[model samples]
Target: MALPSAVKVFLLTMNRSLGHVRQVEARPLPPRNELQQSVLVKTFEELFAELRQKAAERPEGSGTVAALDKGVHFIGKKVVEEAAESWMAAEHEGRERTAEEISQLLYQAQCLMIASGLDLEDVYRHL
Candidate 1:
């Protein structure tokens, strides 16, 4: 049973005795610096800070609805403004601009969730 020359070559490459072993350059793993610049983390921090402030502004367990409504309303306003910016970007600039605007819009929406006493993690978990 004669094997093809390619098979013999492949077998030789797999063998530890082969002097023609492939050299794999050991590259340093990518740094986690990108996470420091993550928009998601930044947005979460901003949203949570505002949420805490709004919570602190709460009048000692009185009128939770009012607080929630105020927060939601403010977030809704931000969303609308962001949406407008996105639309303008889409019309005037390009996809890159529009994507940036949309990212801002998502951040605003996340703020709304926080303000409304909702956890973004919960949404992520459910999804």
Candidate 2:
């Protein structure tokens, strides 16, 4: 089965920080299912690689590949839009709804990362 897009998003965003979040008993992703740390680690790594491979394909004409090809400003607009939606969700709803919005925001950020040609490693190096 294909993984959910949100799972793929984490592969880009995950850093060493999550482990600390867990250990500290801080709720990193509230309203998320109680996904085991191991499951999250395994699935996210596999799915993230898959997304990167798809991006490398650079499909022509339409869809996500085409949207990304339109360049930075287009991608930036999407990121901004997603961010606003997420903020509104967090303010108005309970944890579950907020989680969904956050997922959308992360997925948009992943799109921007793909458009920038920056893999997770590039992000790590930058940080």
Candidate 3:
């Protein structure tokens, strides 16, 4: 069936107007609050416990400071795993996926800090 010339022109005009309206309303996005201090604390505690176990398992290292370094490798392993998960999430779509992946990454990082006898407060203090 052949369409009327007037109808075709009206449809084209409307499409053009909608494109312009969208362009005019386009703006930069604000930074999202993906993580917060309270969330960090909770995740940090969990990671810390894991780190403590790793450290206790390897008590061969001398003194407090020296022992801290022994578990660094273990923490490193966890961090690497978290990084891979985060990368996977980033490759996929959706805010929730990224959030969960980032949460894991943060948790592993906290584990590393805890292995070194550090805490969330220490990071905040340094910041």
Candidate 4:
């Protein structure tokens, strides 16, 4: 089955942000014993900081800037769409795919939060 145009666009934007283009090849996973140690570490706090900077700077060709320029409603819709995609990926695809979708969901949700003038501290206070 073919993906929706919006999904394709989102993937393209994400790929560009990651310095990737058109096709990406999958590399073999690490040995089971090394899996835990080999995992790439990241934090939403770091991501939010970057997004906040992007919002302030509006760098050329930045996906974050593009999303912010489109305003909160568009980012909100993307967050909702990504959430559904994440659920679908978990149900139909396996762990790796689910992780990818969840990453997208988090990015979009963060974009929404930034556009709404909220930050990690605001969310943490509520939780």
C-alpha lDDT of all candidate models, in order: 0.65, 0.65, 0.62, 0.82
Error of 3 at 68 (Å): 10
Question: Mind giving the per-residue lDDT tens digits that candidate 3 earns over 85-109?
Answer: 8877865756689878888778667
CA error at residue 5 for candidate 1, angstroms? 30
TM-score of each: 0.43, 0.59, 0.43, 0.69
- Tens digit per residue, CA lDDT, model 4, 31-69: 656765777655788888888888998899998999899
lDDT of 1 by residue, 55-79 (tens): 5676666443354666787768878
Candidate 4 residue 30 C-alpha distance from true site, Å: 15
What are the root-mean-square deviations of the candidates from the true structure over C-alphas? Answer: 17.2, 10.9, 15.7, 14.5
TM-score of 1: 0.43
- Which candidate number has the best lDDT? 4
Per-model clash counts, in order, read 0, 0, 0, 0
Cα lDDT for residue 79, model 1?
86
lDDT of 3 at 38: 30
TM-score of 4: 0.69
lDDT of 2 by residue, 19-80 (tens): 43222222244333555543453243454566566677865654667667787789889889
Q: By summed lDDT, which 10 consecutive residues of candidate 1 come out lowest?
A: 6-15
**1 or 4, greater by TM-score:** 4
> In model 2, which runs have C-alpha deviations exceeding 4 angstroms?
1-25, 28-47, 58-62
The C-alpha local distance difference test score for the whole of candidate 2 amounts to: 0.65
